[model samples]
Each structure stands twice: as structure tokens, then as C-alpha cells.
Target: MTDTAPASSPAESPRVIALVDDDRNILTTVSIALRSEGFVTRVYSDGETALKALLDNPPDLAVCDIKMPRMDGLQLLQKLRETSALPVIFLTSKDEEPDEALGLAMGADDYIAKPFSQRLLIARIRAILRRSALVRGAPEVENDEQPAEAIRRGRLEMDPLRHQVLWNGQPVSLTVTEFLILEALAARPGVIKSRNQLMDAAYSDDVFVDDRTIDSHIKRLRRKFRSVDPHFGAIETLYGAGYSYSDG
Candidate 1:
């Protein structure tokens, strides 16, 4: 005898992911990953089978390889976009800037080149899915109802939702490392965070990385801020204590 739920109840539907790639290894790897993430994947070696499935029922997202026989990824993307507004990402062997730009122009939300780290790939996937979820009948994100907006200082405004930092009424581009460092320091105001603490917070699980790399990245970031203004002292270093962000 087996215990069963009521037959009138319905089972949850997994997120459908349509993946198009010719490589068997890639298809298998992607299917396994998506499945682990509660995503139901349909993979096709060629563009034909994938296109038919997409026409029958669109997937939540698509991760496609650019170089494929019969119909290339770009062509398939074009065909899909003809009628659907589904989100798509392109994985390409070509690392050329123009190739990436072309994929972006062709409606790819993001483009990853060959030999990418699987962990980074997962992060990208989550980011795309989060964005898609927000766009599709859902709010971006919500915390407890008792919180206010982020702390602001000087001309810099931090938007954690969009991962953006506006400086002097203009958006400034910062790498992931830079953004995290800025956020951690900016939130503390006058409180100085030691380099070790920053390394722990920003690069917690990061291995084989040296503290000098942090210094190097900060140097580059400071150089970029130098372009903003000479008198601008957004990030202040406290001799040996660490760094803090302030307008004064």
C-alpha cells in the first residue's frame, strides 16, 4: 500500500528550457545542470527539432550555441524572435568584440565565449532568469516591509536592484569586484574596513587570489575616479585601517 495525495491536485510544472547545440557533451551537461535547477530542458542537436518544439510551446529561456549546422544559432534566434519575445543567450566560439555585439544586437540578453567556467555560467543563467522573471508579471525583488532605500553619499547613488552606481549624474561602469568593494565601503561611511575584512566579504570563497590583486583593482578603480574630478575623494584610505567612502 502506498500513500498518495488527492488525484484532484495538480503537480508543479518545471521551468522549461530549450537548449540548442550540436555537441553531445554540451547538450548532456546543460540538461543535467538545468534539471538540477528545477528546469525541464529539451535539447536538440540541430536547429530543426528545437524550432519545432519552440513553436509548439515556448521555453522559459534558451541557451544556444552560435555555430551549428543546418540553421545557425543566429538564424534560429531570428526565426524565434519573429513571433516570440522570449529571452535568449548566445554561447559562441568567437571571442571577437563584433561577434558579441552582433549577438547582442540580434536579441541575445548576454553572450558567453568558448571555454567559460561552469560556475560563472550558472551565475549568468541565474541573472538572466531573474531578469526574465522580473519582466514577466513579477516584481523585481522584495525584502521585509520595514526597510528603507539605500544610503546615498555625494554625487554617487547606488542601486542594488540594477547593480548600478551613478556618479555626478552619469552612470559609471565597474566590474563585479569593484562594485562589491564600493558597496561595502559606501555603506559603512566613516567606518574603515580593513583589507582582510574586505577580502573576506568580497572574495570569501575566492582561492588562488592574492591580496595584491585587490590593491591592483583598487588602483585601477581610483584611476577611473580620477577622471570624475580632482577634488573628488569618494574612497578614502585610512593609512593602515583600510578604506572608506565619503564626499568629505
Candidate 2:
């Protein structure tokens, strides 16, 4: 295990992100990048080594590679989900849509393909950290003026502050991206939001994700809700326009 502290002054406790990968180069480079951004990091060589530490002393979030020696990222995520809701971002090989889809369905917050840009990863890290902070009751740097209120539309209830979602009174687990997308739609029931609009809502201005990413997230969101309520159909898809939420 390699741990690196933030480069910035310690005014408050810096957010901790665990990096799990078999490649030594990735661990070293990503750790340096995160440290420079004032984020403390802990790196593990494989998922087996990572799982114990991750559960014992959970980080704010984790960035894990899908392919590893002993335990794979998918197995690790499955085990982690049994006990924790810790945010996770998967690192996958390019064109591995099945793995990406599986990871999202298994509760990964997001994924970036291998040979990815460090800037994009950082942006994603910051995004997930911000959402995790909201769930942990940490003060949000953006939109502090706006109240963090619980949103209720028919059988769907979302607590932005707690980052909790309930369908028909049963709790449903959602990744940060899923939560943001759902929040945007449920915030205004019956209003259609284009793919671009949903992307803007879920990701930062600097980061770019394709339409399929949004569609995949939407699919996972519906699956999650349906897991709790078999008749869940609040989210409506318009053939060529976009998606809308209809509580009625």
C-alpha cells in the first residue's frame, strides 16, 4: 500500500481516494495527479489487497481497474456492496461495453476506459466526491444558498442531502450519476430533458460523455427502481426527443 498526502495546506481533512490497479505505473501517476489536486490517495496493487482496507477504513471514493490478479473489480464491488455504499469508479478497457454495463448495474458510480485522460478522471473524482460529501452531510461548495430538501413525486422520494432514494417506501441504492439524473427529471415532472441536458446535470462542464452513457445510466436507474417496485414506470422515454418523469 502506498499513501500520499495532499500537496495543499491542511485547513480541513482532505478527501481520500483509493486507487486499485495491477499496473504500478497507473497507481504512481494517478496518485501524483490526485495529490497535486490536494487530494490524499491510497494505492493498492490488486482488488484482494484493496477490499479489506477499503471496508475497514473506507475512503470517500475508489477508482479501481476491472482486470486484476486475485480478485477482479467486479467481485470486489459485489462484496463491497453487501456492506457499504462507498462510491466507486471503474477503469475498463476500451470497447468493453458489457463490463461497463455490468459495473454500472452492480453499483459503480462511473467508468472511464483505459488509456484515459488524467484530467477527465480528476473531474470525475471531484464530481463523485462532491456527491459523497452531500450524502455525508458535508457543506456543498456550490449551491449553498439553495436548501437541500427531500423531493417527493408520487411513490418516488429523494433526499438530496442524505442522497437517499425510496420507491414505495423501500430504499433503492443509486450511484451518484444516477441520483443526479433522477433528481433533474423528478425535479420537474412531465418536463422532457434532452440527453445533453441530462449530461450537463450529472457531469461537470469540462467533462464530456456520449449519449449512450446517459442512456446506460437511465437504464440502470430504471432497473434499480424496478428492483424495489416491479411496476415502476415514472421515467418515460420519448422516441426522438428525450426522457421525462411523469409521477401521475
Best by the TM-score measure? 2
Among residues 3 or more apart in sequence or in different chains, the pairs in candidate 2 whose N, CA or C atoms overlap within 3 Å are: none
Give RMSD to native, each candidate. 10.4, 2.2
On the 0 to 100 scale, the lDDT of residue 150 in model 2 is: 90
**How far out, in Å, is residue 37 in model 2?**
2.1
**What is the lDDT of every predicted structure here?**
0.64, 0.86
lDDT digits (tens) for residues 1-248 of candidate 2: 97788767567788899999999999999999999999899999989999999999998899999999999999999999877778999999988879988887777888899889999899989877766665445665555634257999998899977778888899987777788889899999999999999988877776667887788889878887887778889999997889999988
TM-score of 1: 0.51
lDDT of 2 at 112: 94
Q: How many residue pairs clash in each candidate at the backbone level? A: 0, 0
- Alpha-carbon TM-score of each model against the true structure: 0.51, 0.89
